[model samples]
Structure formats: structure tokens, C-alpha cells
Target chain A: GESVGLHLPTLSVQEGDNSIINCAYSNSASDYFIWYKQESGKGPQFIIDIRSNMDKRQGQRVTVLLNKTVKHLSLQIAATQPGDSAVYFCAENEGSSNTGKLIFGQGTTLQVKP
Target chain B: GAGVSQSPSNKVTEKGKDVELRCDPISGHTALYWYRQSLGQGLEFLIYFQGNSAPDKSGLPSDRFSAERTGGSVSTLTIQRTQQEDSAVYLCASSSMAGGSYEQYFGPGTRLTVT
Candidate 1:
């Protein structure tokens, strides 16, 4: 469990096991959410995204679940590996129009243990 | 098919000095953004640019912080009278479109250290 607008929390899981990282966003008007993965010393790389219309979306080995009621979002990685270890971030699109401005939540550092 | 690129991957500047960071967005991408991440902190939205439209400067922290995108291609984020608190990794991202639904490609980022 994580709080809104706080420092990043960490999740450690053994290799081959699934890992779940949670985020609580602050805005109720946000209609889109995105998950990103960032390796040490690198920028965030987009992992998966889901619109408000959908509660869940799946990608290769990754799944994003959104709960609008609680403003909570989670990223589940299947069969986590060492290469999958990174800081996971959930961002909300607060822009009402077509602009891409985003408000990011505190990230979760996912550590995979071999 | 190049991704977003940032220059001066590392910067060390004295307090009160000014620093400029550059970002080259993906080819033909119409949206560019700047974000700052302090150590152990999440990304902070700074500014955003969409094509030739006026940029959204609402996220800027203060009057000393400013940015500009020239010719709708490259963007520069300038921090005037830099302070020690300005030390952080500055990240740049670009989206193929100007909308929130599109994915944003990020650069490696510039690490700025103000002493």
C-alpha cells in the first residue's frame, strides 16, 4: 500500500514470481494513466497505458489495473526477472484538451531477487 | 527512427550561475515536455510544448525558470540564477501527437549539479 504524493515505496520479489506495484493518484479528472519503467541512470520508458474507460489493459508480460473509485493504479509484472528491475511510475494526464502535460505519482522501485 | 535525445548528459555549475539543457524530440513529434527528478523523488512536471501553440508554463517553479522550443523541433530549458536546490536530473520527452492518449518517448536526461 502507498499514499498519495509521498516518496517512492519499494517492492522486492523473487525471480519468476509476479510483482505488484501500487500508486495512488490525486486527481479525479484524470482520464488517462500511464506506467513507465526506468533503469538506473536512465529516463523512464513507457511500459503500458490505460484509458479511464478501461479498468485493465495487458501487454507483453505486463498488466495495468486502474481503480477510479480509490484513485489507485497497479502494475503487475508476470514472472519477474532481474532485467525487469526498475523504478515504476504511474502518471496521470490532467490536461483537459489534447495537451500531453502529466502529473506523476511517487514511483515504486521494483527489485527482483535471483 | 531515432528516439528523444538530450545533450550534456551531465552538468556541474556554481550557484547563481545559469545553465541550459537541450532536448531533441523524435522526428516529426509535435509534443515535447520537461520534467525534473530530485534524488529519490518522482518526476516533477516543468513545462510542455505542443507544435506552434503557446507552451504551458504553469508547471514552472519560479520566474527564474524558462524554456523555449524553436521551429517546433528542439527545445531548451534554462534555469537562471541556479540554486543548490536546482540540482536534479532533468528529463525530456516527446509524443508523436499533442494529445494525452499518445505515448511519450524519453531521453536519457541531463544530471545537473549546482554547488
Candidate 2:
């Protein structure tokens, strides 16, 4: 059974500090991976995504690193702020499937202290 | 310019009853997806519809769970004889198939409580 899991259930960081959330995936054939941020009472918002062909991808203030060898993924936030507090999830798309279904990992709740 | 929208932000139904959840995808989006998120849990794939093709329901938990997309626009997920374990937030997402993009925009999920 393919599964995605987070290494930590909760991460508390002081405001303006860098934060890193880790995820491990069981399936090596997953070609596309994404990081989503879900705020209270709101839907998950796309943060950053990386394809298997790429080792790292960066966005505005975030970065997603994919290590295909270890089947691990990570999301890094620079200068974390109070507004960055939310649950973060990592999802993978199986390479063999074209249906666009995603396998998600248990989320990591990020709490930013002021 | 609008994103995906779901009806009835919250739903409470008794066990053994049926409930229908609706989803409106973004305009011109050819792909729509349904997912379930339990408390403190990640999203679970439920069903997917692309254009006019047959929906991929492999992720549906059981026979009691079913969904349909009309005119390739809006979608409906219905649960029959719901159980307390069925309580969760149902999420809907839409993505444009153009250029083989896989980015999906999600809607505020409907929190379902089966009492």
C-alpha cells in the first residue's frame, strides 16, 4: 500500500525563524509532488510543487525539495510569520496514473509564535 | 475569475439518512475532483471527473458513496445510509487540463456530521 507520512505532527517556531517540514513517501514511482497549506476554516492552498525530474523548486518565500532516492520530500519556509501558521500537507501523484488522483500525507501543524 | 465553490458549508444528518453535496468548478476547467478530510487528517481522494469521460471512482470508500458530474461543470457527491464514521469535511477542486498542468485549486470544504 502506498502511503505518505509526515515525520512530525506539530512544529512550533518563533516568528521570523526558518521552518522545515518533512515528509516521507512509500512509492518511488510518484512523479509529481505538491505542498499545500490549509488555514482554519479554509481549503488547502497550493504552495509549491516539484516533479521527479527536478530536485528542488522555489517559490516566493518557500522551497520544495524532492529526494527521489530516499522517497522523501520537504517544504521550507523562510522567515516564518504568524500568518504562516497552518496545517501543511504533502501529496503525490502516481506516475503510472493519468486520472490525476493524489495520495496525501498526514498533515503537519505549523504554529508560529509572535 | 471565480474559484471552485461548494454548497452548504456545513451539513448535519442523522445516521441511516442520505445527504447530497454539491460542487461548482472553476469556469473552463476540464477536471474536477472530490476529496474527504477527516479531523486532523489529510485529504482522501474520493472521485475524479475529467471533461466528459467516465469518472474514476476507485477512491470511493464504499458502495454507499457515489458522485456525478453534470454537463462537465458541476458535480454532486451523495452518501446513502450514512454512518457516524462518515463524518468529515468534503473538498472539491478543479484544474485546467491545458498544457498538461496539474495544479488544482480547492474550495472551502463542506463539514458533514452524521449524528
Candidate 3:
């Protein structure tokens, strides 16, 4: 089963501040993980992805960290902007060779206070 | 098409009525997927079609829900004897299976409301 949040963790950061969204996955077999952003009325847009073999991966202004020991995944935004306010989702792929049957976690809404 | 597209952005139907939602994948994608997002349930995997074969249908909630992709391109999901529980945003996604990294491109989705 995927990770289900008992409560939607709220992350409120001022514009230009750094924001970190965390997720705890239950499947240790999960190796490929991706972070997606969904606006109010749109499908999720891929932000970044990281393979289990690496602990950290960086994108333009976002980063993904994989901690298999605790089965935790986290996304870090370098400098949060108003445009970054949206719901962030973490999707985990069981393995590298699977057909990409992803198990998604309950999303966390990032509110950037401008 | 430039990206995945779904027909009937929004649909409201009466209970026990039937409804069909359509999805047109990217021109060359060989793998297509269907997902459902209900009020409390996060996005859930409903079905998957690779090429013309669906190696997995384990995610479908009930026998009433069915999906198929024709010619490995366009696909449709039909709900029989619609119930209020079936109301949700049905999302369609596609990806190139041959490539090493599989990234699913998703459509805006069809919001179905059963009254």
C-alpha cells in the first residue's frame, strides 16, 4: 500500500523562503520516485524524480531526497515563489523494471505566503 | 495531438445511467493508463494497457468499471449502472514503453458526477 497521511502536513513559507515537503513510503521495494505539482483544476505536472540508488537529486529549483532506511522521500524547493503554491504529490515506482505502476501518497498542499 | 486529451470535460448523470469517458493518447505512446480520484481516495490506479495488452487490471474497484484501448491509441472507460460512489475525476495517462525512463503524460481528466 502507498503512504497515507493521517493529516495533511501544512508547509507555509514566505515568498523567497525555502520549503521542504516530506513523505514516508511503506514499500522498501520502491526505487523510482517522482514529485508532481497539481494546480486547482489541472492534472499533476512532473517536477522532478530520483532513483533509490541516489540519496539526492537536484533540478532547477527543486530537489528530491530518498532515504530508504526510513522509507522516506522529501522534496525541497530552493526559493519558494507564489507560483509554486499548489498541491505536491509523491509517487513511488516499485522497481526500476516495472511498467511504472506507481503508488501515490496523499498529497501535501504548499502554501506560499506572499 | 500535442498531448493526451479527454472528451466531455464534465458530465452529470442520473443514478443507474451509463457513461463513457474517452481518452486520446499522444501520437506514438505505446502504454496507456487509467486512474480515478474520488473525494477521499487519492489518485488510484484503475487499469493499464501496454501496446494492446493489459497485463494488469488489479486496480479496478469493481466489475462495473471497465476500460480498453483500441489500436494502441485511443481508449475508453465505461461505467455500468452508475452509482454515486463512481463519481470522481477519471484521469488518463500515456507513456512510451520502449524508453528506459517511463514518464506518464496525463490528460486534464473528465469529472463525472452521478446524482
Instruction: Give per-residue CA lDDT, model 2, range A49-88, as digits (tens).
Output: 9888999999999999999989999999999999999999
Provide the fnat value for model 2, as a fraction from 0 to 1.
0.69
Model 2 per-residue lDDT tens digits across residues B7-88: 8899999999999999999999999999999998899999999888888998899999999999889999999999999999
Better of 1 and 3 by DockQ: 1
Q: Rate the local accuracy (lDDT) of all candidates.
A: 0.88, 0.93, 0.84
Model 1 agreement with the true structure over B39-90: per-residue lDDT tens digits = 9888988999988889999889999999999999999999999999999999
Badly placed stretches (over 4 Å) of model 2 are none
Report the Cα lDDT for candidate 2. 0.93
List the candidate 3 regions with Cα displacement exceeding 4 Å: A1-8, A95-97
lDDT of 3 by residue, B1-115 (tens): 4999998899999999999999999999988889898753468989988875644788889999988788878999999999999999998988885645567888999999999
Q: Candidate 2 versus the native: TM-score?
A: 0.97
DockQ each: 0.74, 0.78, 0.62
- Determine which window of 10 residues in candidate 1 chain B has minimal summed lDDT: B96-105
Question: Which candidate model has the greater lDDT, 2 or 3?
Answer: 2
Which candidate number maximizes lDDT? 2
The collision pairs in model 3 are none
Kindly report which residue pairs in candidate 1 clash with one another: none
Residue A8, model 1, lDDT: 43
lDDT of 1 by residue, A46-95 (tens): 99999989999999999999999988888889999999988888887874
